[model samples]
Target: MKALSESHYWATNKKKSKETDQLSPFKVLVRKEVSDHVHSWRFILLLALVLLTFFASLYISMSNIRASFSNVNDPDHAFLYLKLLSATDGSMPPFHILMSFLAPLLGITMGFDAINSEQNSGSLTRLLAQPVYRDNILLAKFYSAMLIIATLFISLTLLMIGGGLFFTGVRIESQEFLRIIGFSVLTIVYVGFYLSLSIMLSVAFRHASTSALTALGIWLFFTVFYPILVNLAIRAFLPDAAYLTQGEKLAYNELIMDIMRVAPGQLYSDGATTMLMPSIRSLGPMSMEQLSGAIPSPLPLRESLIIVWPQLTGLLAGSIAFFALSYYLFMRREIRS
Candidate 1:
């Protein structure tokens, strides 16, 4: 009887301890992940690359704006040039474009080896031996990657804003500042999408290098090659479609182009245009010229948001869905060599 009672007591204690561990396992995991990331050279390289690219692009853009100002005789042209320099809209200078591309690469670099490295080093087994839950491992790595990406973004944004103030001698309005913040948020979401993708690939592959390369390949496909491929496919499938009259055939061609714009880069380009140019209305079904005739006026911010909301929601939803699938797969995967 005493033996059975002692066994029951020990089992109860073990369960309680596990419950306690589960409650705070992610905290320790996050701390360890942050420490590991800070010590890595990749983090430093990513920061350096982002800063250097930003400054270089900013200098070129400012120089071009200054040259335009000097060459223009009309007062209106000067005012227009100044407005372009001061505006934060979709016509984002080269610096913004550079950062958007760089941000995803940075995210991939930070997360591509997160899980596989631990597995390769045999640390994963030891870590799992602890009372920590498996979900904590994934959550901690994700949060750490996000923190690094956010810090890089904030640092670069401040530098750009400071440079704008120093060179342009214009104070940004509160509303414009808010717009910049909104752009940053979208940029972060873009980065997060890639980071989750990298994590998923990291778990899917055995070698860290393979995982990273796979992520890069996907990035290139989506960002660069995918659009070209899509265009070719469309052209092949719809040869002579563009030469068709501006009636039903032209309408059909436009429909095909709209469907193609579902790709992330095209979607983002359209969304950015709407945000940056008050003159832009609907970007999916109709061109700016067409929309202008229908409204004959600039769209309000609310209307602009409504127009692009579908693309934003779709991209965000796709990212979340992909990550959820990855999480489910990782949780169920066997840890065999």
Candidate 2:
């Protein structure tokens, strides 16, 4: 009777697992990863950091905007909400810039231990022994990280919009609100590029520490050193920059900007700049001929989309390519050790 009871227990568990698999094992894996991230101390620390920057920037912006309004009329403040975000009067970096810098950290934190840690602990092979598919594991990992980022970004954006409405006393245009939404969504995508690359490293490297250090190295180089290198390259290409005519100078600067866009950080900053400040009419330094007769006005949503579409696509493409490469590597990797 005891032997029959054990057989029955195993049979029941097998049936339940089969049903669960049919229901989509990926969903179960995603839920587990999401729950782990939400509860982890690492996530709590990142959340606190995000909130610190979010509120500091928002409060400073409110004070600045209120001060600006002390000397202005009411109707004109309608289109001035963006000034609260973009034009920091020596208090703190703009909300967008702060996010641009810290957002990558969140991605890195979530993804750098995604795969290698499990492998290092010897649970990776056991996990594969389960009913879950291999693709489901990796896909769940990436998607869960993306979902967390999207939630954080959306919440922060709504918080900013609410704070601006209540404290900034500026009338936000409908178009401006839509643009802000688009900007928040694009920021998540930009962060995902880093998240995907970091996960790829996690899969490729044996040690979680090594993968994390590699990711941080890439981030530091791109964020800190790449721009300087790009500038030097521009100067190298233009040895006599001082002797160039204004037209030549503008052309060279545009070339420099185009080359810098190859870096994901630059692409994101350019997109964020264009989204947050619609008054920016051009990415490159504008010649007088181009600026002549140009009315200083905020562009419509459609025009801004057209401007930043390339950057958006680039971020998306980089993320997908890195994910595919990671998937390939993870599949080829053996756990027989």
Candidate 3:
């Protein structure tokens, strides 16, 4: 009886070990990546900077919250919770604007060295020598970074909600909550675009610094130089003239906006603005006929989403495309020690 029981125990242990071996590689890689990010000094510093700016924006917004809707009769006054996010004291910009700028840096910092550093340090070869597949490495890194980004943004959103509640003694309505949730998801997608771009650069460039600099350069160009160049090009080519009719001018302005939306920053801004501001009815110049009989009241959550749907789709599609590029590059690259 003792011999039979011992053999049963050994067999059970063996089976469990096999199951563990089968499941461990991908999960272990993801956990390791997440742990490193959480413990790293660079991540710590960036998180602190984000938090500081968040608190400053929150304080400023709370201070001037009442002033944001001074007209008690205004329909927007009903959304005091949202006002906490979009309101600015003119001393500092609102939280979403600050976030739109800083979030990309956070994404870039997390992913700029994801692959190159591993390859440079001679870990990629050994990692692949294990049971883990090449695709698992790239997928684990991207998913882990995205998990961290999602957590950080969700926590920040909750903190903003709590802070607004405490400051104004107003609870968030269902529609307001949904809008905030939409904004948070939009933010994650927006940041994912940068993260994937940086990862793609990391795979394309052998050195981590090169990838980092390239990502920053792209961001700087979009944030500063790209808009200037677009303006210059428009002025030079599609110049608006006094002789142009109202329809022609409107079409020209819309054409400019469509071109500007190609920049990720503009897309994020338009989406964030539309998500946060329920009173904004249209994104582009509307004809007098289209504006006729339109109410000035705040739109429902669904209507606001409709206004920003194209922006959301664009950000999501861009992120996926960049990640796909990174995956392709990482898979085809030679792993040498």
Q: In order, what lDDT does every prediction score? A: 0.70, 0.84, 0.90
Per-residue lDDT over 115-220 for candidate 2, one digit per residue giving the tens place of the 0 to 100 score: 9998888888888998878899999999998898888888877777777777645667787788788888888998899899999999999899999999999999
lDDT of 3 by residue, 1-337 (tens): 9999999999999999998878767899999999999999999999999999988988887888777768666667778778878888689889889987998999899999999999999988898998888888898999999999999889989999988878777778999998889999999999999999999999999999999999999999999999999989987997556878889989998998999999999999999988888889989988898889987788988889999999999999999999999989888888889
Model 2's lDDT to the true fold?
0.84
**Ranking of all candidate structures by their TM-score, best first:** 3, 2, 1
Worst ten-residue run, lDDT, model 3?
A: 68-77
Deviation (Å) of 99 in candidate 2: 1.4
TM-score of model 2 vs. true structure: 0.88
Candidate 3 Cα RMSD after full superposition onto the native fold (Å): 2.4
Q: Which is the better candidate, 2 or 3, if ranked by lDDT?
A: 3
Of the two candidates 1 and 2, the one with more favorable lDDT, higher being better, is 2
TM-score of each: 0.79, 0.88, 0.93
Q: Over all chains combined, what TM-score does candidate 3 have?
A: 0.93
Candidate 2 residue-wise lDDT at 44:
98
Worst 10 residues of 1 by lDDT: 74-83
Model 1 lDDT per residue over 1-337, tens place: 9999999999999999998767677877887888888888988887788777666656555756655446444322333222342333234455545655787787788889988898999889888888878888988998887887787677766766787787778776554555555556666777787888888998888899999999898878878787788778877877585567656575776677676666665666565555554556556455445646573454565787787777677668867876786789789987753
Off by over 4 Å in 2: 1-22, 68-77, 168-171
In the order shown, the candidates' Cα RMSDs to the true structure are 8.1, 5.0, 2.4
